[model samples]
Target: MLVKNISVVAAFVASVCIMPAQAQNNTIVVKANQLKADIQPTMWGVFFEDINMSADGGIYAELVKNRSFEFLKPLAGWTFKGKERKEGDLLILNRQDKQTNNPRFIQVNPNHTAKGDFGIINEGFRGMGIKQGLRYDFSMLYRQPAAGVKVHVELLNAKNEVIGKTTISPVATGKEWRKLEASLEATATEPKGTLAVWFEGSGQMDLDMISLFPGDTWKGRKGGMRADMVQMLADLKPGFLRFPGGCIVEGYDLSQRYQWKKTIGPIEERQLLINRWNFEFAHRPTPDYFQTFGLGFFEYFQLAEDIGAEPLPILNCGMACQFNTAEMVPLDQLDPYVQDALDLIEFANGDASTKWGKVRAQMGHPEPFNLKLLGIGNENWGPQYIDRLQVFTKAIKEKYPKMQLITSAGTDPDGERFDYLNGQLRKMNADIIDEHYYRRPEWFLQNAARYDNYDRNGSKVFAGEYAAQSDKTVSIHNKNNWRAALAEASFMTGLERNADVVVMASYAPLFAHVDGWQWTPDMIWIDNLHVVGTPNYYVQKMFSTNRGTHIVPILKNNAPLAGQDSLYASASVDKTTNELIIKLVNVSANGLQQEIKLDGVSKLSGNARHYVMKASGLDVENSLKEPLAIVPVEEQWKASGKSLKVNLAPHSVNVIRVKHLDLVSFKKAGKME
Candidate 1:
């Protein structure tokens, strides 16, 4: 009865095919038996950077802002009350000559503060979101002259009512800085809380690296990430996590390049630096943006492990950002940068007894992170890039020969610079060449067959960063709309079809804050206490979650379905699940029906499911108020015999999953066609 009902439903589905003046309903025949290539688990991933408050106010669970006295405006987030202002009274001293790495510290004038209790209040990052009964860890570096100065810390709510308090008095009289720690247990929950530090009966207290962290962070680590934010990433089930940056690795200048060593070690000692995104976008300037490195390399590795993803950390390759300074380090001085790469490997994979491994062990993860692939540089161009790349390739091969390396194809996916680098890297037999593209939705739809003609013998491809720009490149008016995600999904069918050539792909600038973002069309958006997955996020999620082991061809009239009547499709058979997974996209403005005939399988279970993501229009988008606006809708699909019919909704992405009957049943019905 079920088979009969499925057959009737399939006939109805096929009969509904209609033709319009603009386009006709197409028939997509899936050759389930014709196997293509295997899909790599690392095909889908995430690219993260510290841009747009992505780390401090976005992910890292440190509630206090400007915890370190390193921002250009030293006390940008702090307000002082009952304070005397005079020359040398409140000073920011830099010990650059001695403590070269950490140069800034606050020096309060003792003579001027003797009259009253001086208080410093931090407004936090858009005000702290404190929960009732939660504990907050507070720590700071202090250089005291005597035991007379008592620092009282208090957490205050909107009404200026203190919910928690702690006191710290420096007992020693010396110039050397000492670390002090205290904990506060909030009596009531307050979404917006402020921290106040009052200096009473003071002499002189020099402070730097002041910080506060919530106790309930991911994995309960003292200075770890926000549980909710990390949970969202974990839920996506990404295969790999590309860390540190897109442009941050190559700084505005070589002097400001991301130095991994400076990022590790004690939080107090991890020197703060200005984030490149601080002023990169003049139209959307964020002057308060800075990198404290609290969520540094070690944390990145830990995050990758926590989310069950491979860590792909790209390093500085003797070149700064080409768009800016195009600074280069001499060949002789390049050894340090090269050595950093070698040490990074040891830190990630070497035994505990090793030097760098010991530092990693001290950071709470003694076990190796199972380092595999390493990217040399990010989006560098010209002969200058190749020259330095050759040096790194030779050195890394001589040492860790088995370690797989990824090389960049400049700032574009094509043109002179990209063509030259691709040729050179291919000649070098580079393990994988990274490619990037940020194009219009129409461009994505047109280039759905971009890799169809790629040389199979050349270096493999890693689509390192990409997103469909809805408006224009770097446009402030761009959006993460349905049209962009739909186009990306259509292009992804081609990437899956050529899985043998493209090994990894991920969306860039994985996160953005609604109020603090500099980049548009990001994958995920977050606020202080909430996060919303854009339409693009769900599109990536669907493909990643249902990734099949082997690709299968879904053709029409013996031709690959690439924009045939505005219909795009790709099919794959999962070896583990013994199911046929077909992906389809309808870019047309009208609904269409397709008849997919399974050639190799005689019988498929009538029970199947269809997952469809559709919207009313191309411009539809998800908002914080309605986060699920563009999410998928799932329902059981009816099918029978070797022919299955499906109706494609207008401007939608669909995945149909069906189980294949065993060999015994298939052989029994061999002649039944």
Candidate 2:
């Protein structure tokens, strides 16, 4: 039976004062017979991976081409001899002599061969997983010796079958390095593999700085981010963006850290660095490989501006340990990093007269950027973090006092340390306490109401990192876990109920490029070419985009169904359109058909717009092959009198928009009658 609002409110008030408060019995019902609400339009926000470009990492966006032929053997090798390391994998060779001079080219006879095989493998290729039928522009530097060289470039499928092949001949006596470019089309049959440059029957050849990219024709720009990729993220309508993070900012030491200055400016000068995460996982020797900061700080700011999102930049706190804990720097030695923070703020928000501000203007944006929030560090904690926070907080408060400061609390399961850290931050008057949660789905579901007991007077909360961990077999099969959905919904409800204290929130480790992921269960997963938004992405979108400025008291009728513990509803008025938006969540296994009757609102005579996110199974996800396996669908609703009955699917989120009728029209019609 549909429980009306008027009766539910009386029941809530009666239950509240008369009995002990419990999760199951905490239902509220309105007393008014008439129902009305003013719904407001919601804003959407998206997080961009910045690895090749910024912190959000993937090959397509990562700007620097790290693995070239810099490590190739000299004349002892078939292709070239005496390779001088350029950037990451870029190697330059001299062609003057073989013994005395470095041999840039090698003569490959019928029988004579080099010690190792020299052919393009997976190395040095970006966006290898790009979809077929897409156009990509390829560029590289090659020099020919006195004798010309012939090379065959083939796009091979996963099975090593050549899907597309092209041959190129370098002109004789090509001494200096010359730029060679070609446009390649990704065919429909092109399996997921590398576009290999095979040097067979080579006379003399030297190559450096090879790059291939999808064409920029889609957006009319020459080159940069893929247009379709950017458009997909833009459609999500992200509200805020947290830049350069998740262990990316917290480097081994001060030198290896992601310095904003190095990444800015032209691509030629930007030195590439080995990602700490990649280096650790690959077990490579050289950890501090220089990173070409091609997509620098300016790009991050520009991206935020372009997408109309609030920029949230994270700075390095004073922990020198690489993935381990370290002692904080002495107060005297901490000045440089602190100054770097100050300068970054100036670069983002200062006028032209300021130092970095002028540099920003020189970069084409004379106007100061809007710097809303600044995070202290990624996930390091302890006395060192606290000490560093003390220094950073003091300086930032003195300079940009209005800017919100966030500090990370260690991710300990007990949450005791987290609680203590929050207390410390509140004592220090920190603006936001960054807490990370990564637990099993069941844990999240059980603790969904954990935040209900939070101290309202304390600093705001930000769930910096969160996602369920799954085994390899389960992820590959594309199975949905109900535990995750339930946890997400429950946690989201806590955030909404405490929205006043939790002003800004975001899920961590947002994207994991198919091969690029070190952690499992990311919100969004993408390969070099194809992408998929995980179930968590949809859950986040539903809550974030439907949020309203003001929340109304919600009343529910009926005893709590066993196993279906709680229900929540909130209402808000859109001042601009005078429409009422109702967000209802039914955390139950059975569908809820409830009668909603709002009070203190009138003239409600309009069709309702309903948006629901549901799936046949809880574990369903959208993949690159099929993006619409699970998506939101909209429908129209007809209201009957002052009460509206809604049938909410089990374990589903529903947003209803009701446009309040105009009183003037009703008055005129009454007079005419």
Candidate 3:
């Protein structure tokens, strides 16, 4: 049944429908002869930010928090276990002057005691997730004055019950630190778990880089990413992976900003920095949060390569976060920052003979990462950013002129800030301007024609970060609901329609942990062991997996079908597959019958494939227990002639792909049979 107040009928009909209301048909005519533009491969991607435990406890497989004893409290995530603490039994020793990179270590002097009588317990980020019958690998760096100390490790479930155990003995006692390793198998599955280390002998020893990782990691790399979580990203087949972060790129202040050079090399030597999100939200304070750099820049590039995506890294523009400090570096003192940007390109793509490139080679990747895109700022705006960007651009262009630079247009997509930056950047001939949007659902519908009036020859656009908000932006109550997802779908049609102007697009704040997230409405939500893609994730996957090579015109009554009668659509043709890809979005609460006509095709198969995603209501969502609550439901569709009729479900997003069998029309478009 159609909505009583709407007429998606004779007004937008194909071939002038003189028929009555009962005979009204939904028709979208695909102009096979009209090719608007070619779609770039980097049209859709995933934006990564190290928020909500996305690194330490979320994706990075390390289970031990404060592994290097580098947090503000040094032992914020660790607790003393067993008998009253003896004097000097555990001491956080700082050698800041000598070991600036990793200045902290724990010294333990245990009395003669049996195993399980004394030690420390590490409460993982939230709690370590353990699985039944899975092996837990533990390793640490240690130094002993004399060799008499032995260590016992235990894995505990959420109930604090021991489920796995192993022991290690250190014999190479000397001035130099030695590494020790052990493994244990868990006997039960638990979402919240802990790791306890017990001492068994009387000896003086020092420990650092204490860690534990599951045997089941991505590709079984000893110290790698979570397999289940990485698989979710691989499933989307994203075109690019934007790394290191949103606000992390621009720290709370310059001193706290993310420095990529400090993140690579031996894991222990990599200096740790406090994660900006640790103190951002007063409502959700996480004082223990910090960047271990275990998942550093090299790992990011490797992950992008593993999933067949281009690497796009963002660098700071010598300015701190505007909302936090708004601190700007002096123009004369910006050399180091500018040099950092220059060195990154060399690190990513320069030859091994180069300094930074040699460092990249030592980390195990000799071949260049083929870096093509670099963003200058996170959300900084005004003449200050422009001034800093100019210096970096002038230096980088002189050295690496071919590199494409992505400039910021501020936090909001449109405002005095955005307008000022947009005009200035365009005047300067910037390559790509990044635009972000986190607004209500109504805003999405209203701006569906945003890029329609953009200059066709100006700097290209990158919808760098955008998501339709169910509640106010940054509110704790915001949800990843169908209403927001559906609105995003309707707006995305405009992006696809303007593919010539928009080269790259991605949703922001990609992953969130259920127990630790400070922000809501993330694309994917994770618990200890399970991962669930929200309604928004499925919507992005549908558009990405079906994005064709070239855009084709899809019209209704000689006008672009955008928010007309509550309908939005875009069409494309895959030259390689010789198939027509059509996307239709129906935001109304009533089903509308659609008749799609292949205008130039004299003969074509009526059979097609329909991928439909619809939920019972806008507020319905997916949870860990019901991960597939809103996934795309695939159906085999068949009609009889040139027109195919599909019933667009109430508040649904649909994708239809049909093979063009007409040789004449196919050859006319330069596509073979």
Q: Which candidate leads in TM-score?
A: 3
lDDT of 3: 0.86
- Which candidate, 2 or 3, has the higher lDDT? 3
> Which residue pairs in model 3 clash with each other?
26-595
Q: Rank the candidates by lDDT, best first.
A: 3, 1, 2
Error of 3 at 214 (Å): 0.7
lDDT, candidate 1, 514-551, per-residue tens: 87899888999987667899999999988888888877
Q: Where is the poorest 10-residue window by lDDT in model 2?
A: 664-673
Task: Name the best candidate (by lDDT).
Answer: 3
- Residue-pair clashes per prediction, in order, are 0, 49, 1
lDDT of 2 by residue, 1-673 (tens): 1223223223322322212234333333432222222111212244333432223234234322342322232311112222232232223444444322113422222112222233544422233454567666666666566543455565667676666556665565457767777767766454255656655444555565455665653344433554545554555566676777756677766555666766666443454555655454442222222344545678767766776678878877766543553535677788888988898999998889989898899888999887868888777766667888998999989988898888887764346776677767888877877777766554454444455556656787776666554333214332334435544655665555445455666665666655545555666666655557766777777766666544444455532111133355555444456665666655555565666765554546879888887666555566777777776689997754555677877666677887763322111011000
> Residue 262 of model 2: what lDDT?
65
lDDT of each: 0.83, 0.56, 0.86
